[model samples]
Target: MNFKEQLTRFPILETVAKAAAELGVEAYIIGGFVRDLILSRASKDIDVVSVGNGIELAERVAARLGPDVFVSIYKNFGTAQIRQCDLEIEFVGARKESYRTDSRKPAVEDGTLSDDQNRRDFTINAMGISLNKDTFGELVDPFEGVRDLKRKIIRTPLEPEITFSDDPLRMMRAIRFASQLNFDIEPDTFDAIIKMKERIGIVSAERISDELNKIILSPTPSYGFKLLYHAGILAIMFPEMIELLGVETIDGKGHKDNFYHTLQVLDNVAQHTDDLWLRWAAILHDIAKPATKKFDKKVGWSFHNHEEVGARMVPVIFRRMKLPLNEKMRFVKKLVRLHLRPIVLSKEEITDSAMRRLLVEAGEDIEALMKLCRADITSKNPDKVKRFLHNFDLVEQKLKDLEERDKLRNFQPVITGEIIMETFGLKPAKEVGIIKEIVREAILEGIIPNEYEPAFAYMVHEGEKLGLSVQSTGTTFE
Candidate 1:
């Protein structure tokens, strides 16, 4: 297929062709841009490979396109970059690579286009379109990448073992691409990843997490997790998650496999929202099940307080995975702790008081929490799913009504310890805390409106009962 029409989107392609012809250099649009174009997917980043110094070609192209075009050159890596409008174009010299056993960094040497294509990670990315005067938009497919694209397969241009061994991160990339594109990994390539799973250790945590995030953001993340688990890469990289697999039975009672259940929840949430932290909440919602597993004669299996336990485990897991320990981590922790709250409300009589507490605790994350609770319904019985969903709607309605009336989302008590201290003419002490707790409980329990007058009256009564009287004249409750 002719990609000449696609190149018309950027007028600079003509300038690049003219410049390459003048300099006697061969240039082509390669890698992801080519692959995405063939698949009819939209892409903003374009990569170019040239037979001569990529920096020189980029400089000439930049000169032809005038001063507004910016060209950045990295001499050591034999690469250059150009930014124009909304497009970022990266230029690299045609080169071959050979890797040492212990490191992923490749020994680079200048070579022909064929050598460059041979070094690519996958067949889909190895396809290129020439920009020389003789063949301005002819595609070069040394590995029959077009056929592979038609068949929807992810296979390396070179030997699978050698390709993956040279850069173990490609193994993850292969699976990530399969998940993203809904393609299948060829049997030999899949086995190669399994055999070379140990080599993934050489990859940096940041790089691995980057790819994992992409997989998590895919339409169905369970595909990527299954591939990772089957290839043994998940065990090496994320042993904590791998441990969630399997069911241990005692006296003919066993808990469900939390690992598979987590994946199912993840996929279900992915279908609803693309928020990364919410997806993470799904992954970790039941993380403590294995740790808190117990069995009783009457109860088949129980994971008591898994939410609290899982909340405590979030920081350790984030640290191990090299994820940020900022508000994002805290958000996921909060969701894990409160994941079961909505479910409990669904089972019992939905109450405004319980919904108010949930809203206050969840704050802005209440909707995300509800989404997770809905996804957690993984029952095989259709009636059970329907009943839970119907109850969940009622619970959501109660939450909305309570929030509208009480304004309790992220609400703090109107009464403060400072007011208590001033009214009782005392320093910080247990009496002040007791008064504050009583007022807060009174407001939450609907015994008193959240207005200041009622809270102040209740505070005074509690303080008087504790043998303290108002001493400051100006400190009347506002």
Candidate 2:
């Protein structure tokens, strides 16, 4: 494809061209930016490969763009980045690499542009466009990248084994790209990934988790997941998900594969929300089924307390995967634990007390929790699915009505521990906790409205049962 006109789309390319000519070095726009340009996809990050010192070229270009343009240099990596408005232009010297068996980090040295293209992960990403004065907008694809792009295929620029063995993270990127673009990985390259799947052990957990998170956030994550499992990468990196894969049969009765079931729920949740943590919750919602699976003559099969067990596993998995162990982790844990509560509430006789408990427990996250519960209903029979959804609608309406009337979503008990202590003239003991629990439970159980008077009266009565007397009368705790 002739890209002469496209090269003129960005004025900075001209500035880069002038700098390359002045510095007497060959320069080109290469890799994903060129591939994306050919695909008519919008991309702002430009990768510039020069035959000489990339930092010097970037400095010259930054000078041309005026003092306001900033170039951030990474001396160790031999790369420089220029921030020009919304565009990020990365400059690197074309180079060859040699890898050691134990590490993914490669030994780097300056080389011709051909050498750089030879080391690229995929043919499509190996495509480049010249920006030098003599060869402006010339397409360089020694690997037949354009043809592969036309075929909607992912293939290594070199031998698949050598390409993947050099940097094992490319394996994850392969699946991520396929999932993102809905393309196919060439059979040979896919087989090479399976052959070299163990090479991924050299990659850091943080980097692996980053790619995993990207796959999770993709439109159809199940596609990437299946690829991972087939390639054996999923089993190595995340065994918990693998544990959910098989179904056991007993006495002509069997449990549906929770693995595929979880994927369907993930896809279902993906249709409605793009929240990464919520999708993570979907993935882990039934992760403990393998551990909790049991068979009974009467019930056939049951995964008792799987939600709680799965919730407890969240932190361990997050820690192992190098995911953040903060509120995001807490969110996933909370959802995993409470995922079944709403399902039970929907399938049974809906009660205000149950709704109130859910509202208070979920607080501001009730809406998101309800979305997950709805996605969890993956019945093939339309009538059963419809009935569950109808019951969910009733539960949702009750939540809205009760939440508005009682304002329990963010409710705090009117009786505080300090107040309980002051009222009973006691220390911070179990009695103080019991009295506080009574007031909070009373408000949530509809024993009284979340108003102060009834909560206070009930608190006094309970305190009296504990053999404590109120020090003052006609006094409000509000």
Candidate 3:
């Protein structure tokens, strides 16, 4: 079918056609842009394949567009990219590639459009649309990409084994596409992935993490992760997560499969937010359960202090995965550590002190932590879920009331060690730290108000007990 009508939306394609014609070369809009267009998915990135010099075509197109338009060229790779308006169009010479066994990087030489299509990672992405004046909107489907698109299947253009072995990252891409588009991986292609899963070790950690992050960000992330698990890729890529799988029974009592439970929580969180790090928190919330798992005749099974252990594991996992180690990792770690706190509050009595502590610790992330806790309730029994949700609602309301009344979100003690030193005319010492801790705990424990006056009064009283006399007093602690 001709996409002439749809192609009208992107007037940029016309400019490309003009540029290609002036250069006396053939060009086609190929890869993801074509695939997404067929699926009616919005895409701002376009890939244009030229049978001749792509860099020259990009320069010509940039010149025709305007002086303001600039082409960024990577001469070593024979590719050029232009950012025009809200769209990014990359130009590359159509090429067939041969890879060394050790690297995914290919030895490239210019080839026909057919050769380029043959080298695409998946069939749907192999389809191309002509950009020449003679066949401007004609579809090129040598691999029946349109049929694969209709069938909602992910399949390689060449032999699956050959495609994956040439660049094993394509195996992850296959699962990523299936997760993003809600498509099925064809049986042969999936089998090829399992057989060649070990090849993923050669892929860079950053590259694998990029694909894993995309999978985590998909509408339903668990689908992609399950595929990775069954394909044995997850074991190779992230063994910590694989350790969370399976159930063990003792005396006919068993715990829930923490692996599947984590996936359910992941899916549940996906329904509420698109935050990648938060979803990662879900993935790791119970990651330490396997390590902490133990059984007693009375309690059946318990994963004691799993959250704390899991929190410690987050940085190691992030470091190994090549994920960012900044506040993003801290955020995920914080959530993993505190995930059980809200649930524990929901189950038991919701106290002002508990709310205060939770609010103070979670600070700006209380809402995100709450989202994770709600998602963590993955019981199959409808009644248990309903009851827990009711309790969570009560706990949530209590948090709102306490936060509004106490103003404890991002709370810090009004009294500082400097203030304590100045009041007692003392140097920096263990006494100053001790007095500061007293005032801070008093505020969180609700023994005194968080206001400066009450905290100061309490601090002076506590100082007197520490065998220190107050030399001066101020109404303002700051």
Report every candidate's CA lDDT: 0.90, 0.92, 0.94
**Ranking by lDDT, best first?**
3, 2, 1
* Cα lDDT of model 3 by residue, 1-478, tens digit: 8998899999888999999999999999999999999999999999999999999999999999999998899999899999987999999999989999899999998899999999999999999999999898999999999999999999999999999999999999999999999999999999999999999989999999999999999999999999999999999999999998999999999999999999999999999999999999999999999889999998899999999999999999999999999999999999999999999999898778888999999999999999999999988799999999999999999999999998999798888888898899999999999999889889989999988888998999999999999988854555
Q: Report the Cα lDDT for residue 312, model 3.
A: 99
* Full-model lDDT, candidate 3: 0.94
TM-score of 2: 0.97
Find the candidate with the highest TM-score and give its number.
Answer: 3
In angstroms, the error of model 1 at 424 is 2.2
- Per-residue lDDT for 332-416 in model 2, tens only? 9999999999899987888888888888888888888999999999988999999999998988898899988988888788778
TM-score: the better of candidates 1 and 3: 3
Candidates in order: C-alpha RMSD to true structure = 1.7, 1.3, 1.0
Cα error, candidate 2, residue 341 (Å): 1.3
Ordered list by TM-score, greatest first: 3, 2, 1
Error of model 2, residue 191, in angstroms: 0.7
Name the runs in model 2 displaced over 4 angstroms. Answer: 473-476
Best by lDDT: 3
Q: Quick one: RMSD of model 3? A: 1.0
